[model samples]
Target: MMATAVVLDPAVTMRTPEWLFLSTGIRAVDHAVEDICSVTGNVFSEGASMQALRLLSRGLLGAKARPEDPAPRLDCLTGAWMSMVGSQSGVEKGASHGIGHALGGTAGMPHGYTSCVMLPVVLRYNQPVNAAQQAMVSEALGQPGTPAADLVAGLVAELGLPGRLRDCGVKREQLDMIAEAAMHDRWIPTNPRPLDLAGVRALLEEAW
Candidate 1:
C-alpha cells in the first residue's frame, strides 16, 4: 500500500513507464522517453532530492521496519540523486546503473538492488574524472578511509547484494544488446565519461 501510494503521487506518476521499460530488451529511444517522462513529468529536483534524502537517511540509519526499508523510496530517490549527481558533476548517464538495469531486468532483481551493487564499479571507473567527487561518495557511504571505487565494492558486499552480472542470471550473449541500449540512454549525458556503444558494451562484457 505504501509503495502503491508512493508510485501514484504526482512526483512519481510521470516516471513510472520509463522505469518499467528500460529492461534487457527495451529500445534506447524508449529508455529516453522514460527518462524524459521521469524528469519532465515528475520534475523532481532539489526539493524532491532533499525529501528523498531525508527519507533515505531515516530508512538506512534510523529504522528497520517495512516502512523504512528504503527500497521503494530508492526507486524515485536514487534516480533523482543521480540526476543531481549528474548536474553537479557535469556528467550525464553516469556509471553502472545502465548495466544494472539490464541485469536487473534479465534477472528479476529490483532496481535499487542493481544500483546498490553496480554503482561502486562505475564510481571506480569514473574516478580519474574526479577523485573529490568519488571521495564524497565514499564518505556518504560511511567508508571514508576506503578508496572510492573499492568502497563501493566493499559496501555492496557488506549489503549482501549481487557482486556480478553473471551472478544475477545474465547470459554471455546478451551483454552486447544491454551495452548498446545503455549507450543510447538519455542519462548518458550525466556520465563522467562519454561512453560510446562500444565502450558501454565493453563495460558490460567486463561486468559479465
Candidate 2:
C-alpha cells in the first residue's frame, strides 16, 4: 500500500552533490519524456510530463549555476514529483528505462547516469515509431523542431554528463549481457518501437 501522505522538503536536499543532483535531474527528465512518449499516455499525463520537463530544465541549470540557492532545489523537487504523475495513472515507460535497469544490474551504473547515456539513444531509436509524440517532447524542452534526441543529448552535454556507454566504463563486451538482461524488463514489451534481442544489441552498439 502507498503512504497516506508525502512531503517535499527541498531544503533538505539543497546540498545534494552536483553530480548526483544533475544526473538525477536527468532521470526525472527521462521519466517525463518517456511518459509523454508512452503509447498509453493521455492528454493529462502528457501535460504534467511537459510541465515537468520545463521545470526540470530550468531548475537543473539554475542549481548547476548556483548550488547554494534553495529556490532551484524546490523547482527540481517539484519537477521530479510532477514527472511521476503518470506512474500513478498507469503510463508505462519504454526501452530507455528497460535498458537502464539492465545496465544498472550489469555494470552497476548509477540509475541517473544510465538515463543520461540511454535516454537520448532510446529516443532516437523510437523516433520512427512516435515522431509526433517525440516532437512534443522537443517542444516541452523549449526546443521546437529540434529532434528530441538531439535536444536531450545537448542537455546531457550541458550538464557535463557522459552521453555514451563507453564513457560510462561499460566495456564493449558488456553490451551483449546488458541486452540479454534488458529483454526481460517489464518495460521492454511496452516500448513504442518493438524490439528484439538484435534490436536491443544494436541500440547498445550505437550508444557505445
Candidate 3:
C-alpha cells in the first residue's frame, strides 16, 4: 500500500478530495466497508505516486468512517489503481517493498501484513535521503504536520492491522537473514536511498 502511494509521479496534480466527493455522491452509501475489507494487490516516479497517496489517504480515512459508503469506496479503489501507476509506467518498488518481499518469503508473513509492519519503519529509515518525498507522503495521508512514519503507524492501528515484526512471529535472530535476502531483492536498487546489508539489518531491527 505504501509502495503504491510512493511510486507515483509527483508532478501530476490531482484534486483527490474532489474525486472522493464526486464518486461518493450524496447517498451516504457505505463504500468503505465494501472496498477496504477486500484484500488485493508498485512503484515509479515520485510525482504520480504522491497524487496517488493523497487519493489513498482520503479514501482510506473516509472508508474507515463510512465503510458502507460508495463514494469513499470508489475513491479507495481509484486511489489503489492510481498507486500502481508508477510501476506500470516503469518505476520499481523501493526498500519498503523489497524488505516486505523478504519478510513474506522468509518469515512466512502475509504480503499485506508485511507492509503494515515494515512501511513505517522503512519510511523513517529512509527519511534522511527522502525527506521531501516523505513529507509528500505525510500530506497525502492528511497529516502534513505529522511524521510520515507515525501517520502510517496510525493508519495500520486504525485498520486493526499488525504493526510489529514480532506480532508476525519474526524472531530477533531472523533479522540478519531477512536483511541479507532483502539486499538481493530487485527493488532494492530503486529505493530512494542506497541500501546495504547493515542498513537492511537496522531496518529489520526497528521493525522487530
Q: Cα RMSD to native, each candidate?
A: 9.0, 1.0, 10.7
The sequence of per-residue lDDT tens digits that candidate 3 reaches over residues 133-207 is 667667656778788778877777775567889987898998999999998898777676778899889888888
Q: Model 2 misses residue 19 by how many Å?
A: 0.6
Error of 2 at 86 (Å): 0.8
Q: Considering TM-score, which of the candidate structures 1 and 2 is the better prediction for this target?
A: 2
Assess candidate 1 and give its TM-score to the true structure.
Answer: 0.57
Instruction: Rate residue 109 of model 2 by lDDT.
Output: 89
Q: Candidate 3's error at 35, in angstroms?
A: 23
lDDT of 1 by residue, 1-208 (tens): 1122223232433344433322211122112212222222233333343343333333332222333333544443443333343233332345555666666555566665556545555665666766654454445435566775575455345434565777767777887767766665666555666567777777666665
Cα lDDT listed for each candidate = 0.47, 0.93, 0.61
Off by over 4 Å in 1: 1-93, 104-109
* Pairs with backbone N, CA or C atoms under 3 Å apart (clashes), candidate 2: none
Comparison by TM-score, 1 against 3, better one: 3
Worst 10 residues of 3 by lDDT: 26-35
